[model samples]
Target: MKEYEQNQQKNKEHYEKVYANYNLNNILYWLNNLEGYLDFVTNYETSWSALYQNDFRNRIKGKKVLEMGCGDCNNAAIMAALGARVYANDIASTSGKIVEQLNGSFDFSHPIVFVEGDFLNNDLASGSFDFVIGKAFLHHLSLPVEREFLKETARLLKTDGEARFFEPAVNSKLLDELRWYIPIGNRPSKFRGEAFRKWKEEDPHPDRSFSSAHFKKAVNEFFEECLIKPVGTLDRFRNLIKNRKWNGRYAKWALKNEQKLPLFLNSKFARSQLIVGKLPLK
Candidate 1:
């Protein structure tokens, strides 16, 4: 195993904390550098969530679904709403319960299962899901770890099944650097919020942040058909511009006339990347 893979495996609890639990993730994420936090949120809403209603949910009707990182599985709820047999998993029990409460609220009649476990070592049978989704999940993997997980996803996905993924890219140096400062925006800033009194810390590995090109390469290594597009970062940028306290007016104008940006840092670079691929039929 490469050093990073070893490092990741050695820090099993750490990865679980970072990628597994949604509630703690919020606190840990708030502790990340401002730019890193910004990029993370942008990717979460746009890239990972790109499939929310229009794309993945619509396709899930009458299907069996497994959602990786099903933390607060809003998408899973949607799938159940569409008559899917949805199975959602996450390392974060708190968020799993949140998904439960949420589904209960909106889907009292639909059937959905929410499980909490370390997916890498969880004893789920191979080829269990008709479709496997890792929305906002794989970005937590380094390149090598991503490869391992992709292989695992391939193992779990049925011969004709698909695995979809979404993650923020450390694509542009300029934008990546700017990500550290993007506040969570739904509430007060983490740094400026209650965390100021609870913990004094920062992300241990900032260099591991990712970009779409890298994610696309990882997907191609295992899945036969991969589609990746920039979708989230643009929305976050939209949020940054539109928030009442931030640059909302400017964001409205920029979005209204978004074509003014230059060629290199066009809208794509400013968005999150989405990918979908199928296991080889062998």
Candidate 2:
């Protein structure tokens, strides 16, 4: 079987396990699906709130933003609040609920639409967005598809448009050793607990870290400058101090400020990687 089909099958099997367990329930699933999303009018309002106060709004504001693979609209909501015309698309049905919540929360909602489709094959208008954003989406593809993903992103962007991307960067050595006995798969991102629980048995690739290198090279090939930034030490160490469901940790966002501590100094091995790339201005 082809690798993409195989990954899809494993993902399907994993979801089946998740649904069968169901003890975790949909609300948790919804929240977990939010990944970097903090709850406002919902779960962890503090987490969501801090993200906005920091550097998020300052970054992608006042642009026509397209959040590709946006499952829950949290990132889209952030951009929308910053006065961007935000558009999002995902293959899940729950995406509708996310847009509804976003519409209810914000006062000055710019144009926002959520469509359901495969991003790889979907025929979106070329150069539709000034900015395209995806959180933890690209590494899901194998190599050739990764190349195509960049080409597609380039096609969709106008000459000077940008793509804001967040991906999981690996430690390489640590994960490579584990791949020998473990049936290594291409990736283990997105709700890593669930990824481990789901595709744990099927892993096979040993030396593969599936970092943002592919994203950098892919984007750099088309766009002028590709910057890969890292985030999430706060999400990591702070989770130990306070559980959001009970005692919400104010320190989660604090841990990521590399200007303070050396822990977050490097992009690789950080909890997540963010790449902001753009086509050269003419």
Candidate 3:
């Protein structure tokens, strides 16, 4: 198989194992306290804050929204709760079960439609959606696969539709190089030679370009407008804080202020990004 195909299969197996016995208690709690949950994540969580920026919460109500790579279906459930006509896709069949559980447990304005298997094979109609969203998802795909997905996004979206993806940003080679040396969780430091290589072999994320410049250029052909917003430049440091409350406070402050810095600084050093595409060429 080709590299992208191999990565896709790896991701399928990986996420299936990761979410196999997933509990819905946390999601249930959030559903019960929906407004409060939305307020907290949108204000303090880097990925959530970035993806929901520019009044996304308000705009999606009663709109057709497709979520690509909707792992665990938490965001899909949240969007459904917010009154969007949500369609979610994921390679893992386990995600479909999660969606089913959410629909059975909650009374959404419209139940989320789960699309399983490969994204490119979906029979979704053209110009059928008002919005397309993916949270921390694009970086998992190889560049060639990503281009195909973007082309599909253009075909599926209305002319005035928008695509929002919150993804990792690796704009500075120096910062990225240093990041690999500081191990997180099960992954060993890059200096670990064979150990690191073995871990990378199993890692689901494909080795691909993640620069904001590349993203901007890649989407330009499919969409008339592309905006790349840097996120977590300072919020990335919250990982160092041991106190949960303090970390949350710092993240909110950092995310808010990081945007105020000169664009050049944020573009070069931000830990994550929110890429927005509008006016689909199709």
Quote model 1's TM-score.
Answer: 0.67
Candidate 1, 1-282: lDDT as tens digits: 566644454344454565444443443333334345433433333442355424554576777788887755655655565578888876666556666555545533456787666566667778777888777777655666677778878878788888877666556787664554456533334456465323223332324656666766777788777776555333456654555645544443443343455645543475555577776333
lDDT of 2: 0.58
lDDT of 3: 0.92
Q: lDDT of all predictions, in order shown?
A: 0.59, 0.58, 0.92
Q: Rank the candidates by lDDT, best first.
A: 3, 1, 2
The C-alpha stretches of model 1 lying farther than 4 A from their native spots are: 1-49, 99-110, 181-206, 232-236, 242-268
lDDT of 1 at 26: 42
Residue-level lDDT tens digits of model 2 in 39-144: 3322233233333333555555677777776754656665666678887876554565557655654454475677655566776888877877777666666667
When sorted by TM-score, best at the front, the candidate numbers are 3, 1, 2
lDDT for predicted candidate 1 compared with the true structure: 0.59
Clashes of 3: 0
TM-score of model 3 relative to the true fold? 0.96
- The lowest-lDDT stretch of 10 consecutive residues in candidate 2 is 41-50
Candidate 1, poorest ten consecutive residues by summed lDDT? 197-206
lDDT by residue for model 3 over 43-107, one digit each (tens)? Answer: 89989999988888899999999999999999999999899999999999999999999999999
